[model samples]
Target: MPALGGKIDMVPGRMHGLRVQAQREGRYRGQCAEYCGEQHARMALEVVARPPDAFDAWLAAQAGPAAAPANAQLARGQAVFLAQRCQACHAVRGVTAGGPGATLGPDLTHVGSRRTIAAGTLPTHAATLAGWVADPQAHKAGARMPATRTLDGADLRALAAWLESLQ
Candidate 1:
C-alpha cells in the first residue's frame, strides 16, 4: 500500500518500479485493484509511513527480541504458543530459535505493532486475534494455520493477549 497518491504493479517475468512520497506520517491501507484469483480478497496491504527518527527507532526495535510478557496472562499465552507448536510455523525472533516457521509463516516478532491482522481482513485486537487463533480459516479461507480446537475460551484469550503483547 502506497501513500494516497501512489500505486505500483507487478507483472510476471518483468521488472517495474514506481516512486511515491509518504505525504504524511501514518498508516495507509489498500488492496489489489486487479482480479487475481479465488482468494484475491485476502491479498491486502498496508503501508506505515513514519518520520525518519521514528522509522529508525521502529526498525531497531524490530531487529531486537520481542518485548517480554508483562503479566501472568501474557506469560500463560506464551506457554500455550510453545506447547501448541506454533513455533513450527511462526517465529518471535529471540524467543524462538530459527526454524521453518521463521520463514514459512509471517514473523511474529512485533505482531502487536501491526494495525491489522489476517492480511488486513480484520482489525488488530485481542478479540479478533483470539478468534483468528481459534480458527484462522474462518477469518481467511485457505489459511495455513489450522483451527485450534484444543484451547478453551480462557486459554484462547491468554494466547491472543500474549501475541498482542509481542511488540
Candidate 2:
C-alpha cells in the first residue's frame, strides 16, 4: 500500500461476477484484481455497454464467420495460414478447421475485431499481431503458441494484415 501510495488496491482470487448499470453507450475496461502471473499488469477485460437492440446486433456480428480476404495481400496471408501449423492450435472460422489440437488455443474467429491479444497483453494491430505470431514468448512468458520464426518478414506482415482484416 505504501509503495503504491494507496492509489492502487487489489483483491486476490476469483471473481464471482460483475453487474453494472451503464449510463451511456460506450466501451468500459476492467482488469483482474487478483494476481494471475508474470503478465498480470498486461491483463485486461472489456465490457461493451450498449442498448439492448445494439447489443443484439453486436452479438450477431460476433457470431458470424470471419470476413473474407478482400485483396491480394490478404489472400496471400490466407494462403500462408493454410500452409502453416497455426491450424493445430488456433482456428479462424470459415478459414481454419478444428481437429484434435484445434482446441489447444483460443478460437480466433473475431480476433481482428478485438482490442487486445495475448490475454490483453498487447493492442490488436498488424505490428503487434505480427510480433506475437513471430515470438509470443517475448510478449507472454508462458505462451503456448510457438514462434513462427520461419516466416519471412513479408509473409509475416501479410499474415498479420490478413488477421487484422478478419473484422
Candidate 3:
C-alpha cells in the first residue's frame, strides 16, 4: 500500500518481518501490511535510523539506566512508580523493577529517549506520559496497562516528570 510507505510481509506463524536500509537520520513510521488480529490496523512501529555517531550515542544511552530524578518532584515520582508496582510490568535498568522476576511489558529503561510511546501510538513527552499513566486504555484500546486513577494529581505529575527524565 502506498500509504504504508514501506515494504512489509508476514511469514508463517504470524510473524511480520521487514528489512529496510537506513535511508535517513530520523524516525520512520511503518505498519503491518498483513492483518494478524483485531487491532492489526493499530499495530505500528517506528524505526530510528541515525547517522553512525548519533546511533552509537543512542545505543549507549539505551544501555544505561533510567536517568536519576533531578529534583524532589522527580524523586517523589520515582517513589510513586515503585509504590504503584509499575515495575512488575516494566523494566527500568539499575532500578528495582529490573532486579528480578520482572514480567515483560516493555523495557522502559530509556523510554523517554524514544520518539514515541505505547507502541508508537503517541509522541514521547511529559503530557503523553501523564496521560498514559493515568489511563492507558484511553490511548490504546485493549492496552494491558490498567488505569491509574488511584494516583492523585500531584503524584501523577511527579511520576510523569520522572519518566520524562529517564533519558
lDDT of 3 by residue, 24-132 (tens): 5666667776867645656778777778997798688778777888889989999998999999888888776364546557888788887788767889999999999
Tell me the deviation in Å of residue 84 in model 1. 0.5
**Model 3 alpha-carbon drift over 4 Å, by segment:** 1-18, 97-103
What overall lDDT, based on C-alpha atoms, would model 1 receive against the true structure?
0.83
Cα lDDT computed for each candidate against the true fold: 0.83, 0.81, 0.80
Listed in order, each prediction's TM-score against the native is 0.85, 0.81, 0.84
lDDT of 1 by residue, 29-132 (tens): 77887876665789788777899998999899888888888989999999999898888888887788776456678888899878888788888878888988
| Model 2 weakest 10-residue run by lDDT | 1-10
Stretches of candidate 1 off by over 4 Å are 1-19
How much is 151 displaced in model 3, in angstroms? 0.8
**Residue 25, candidate 1: alpha-carbon lDDT:** 84
Cα TM-score of candidate 3: 0.84
Candidate 2: lDDT over CA atoms? 0.81
| lDDT leaderboard ranking | 1, 2, 3
Give the per-residue lDDT digits (tens) of candidate 2, residues 1-167.
12222223444555554345667777666666668677677666666778999889989998999899999999999889889878898888888878988878888888898888886788999999999998998998877788889999899999999989988
**Whose TM-score is greatest here?**
1
What are the clashing pairs of model 3? none
**Model 3: how far residue 97 lies from native, Å:** 4.2
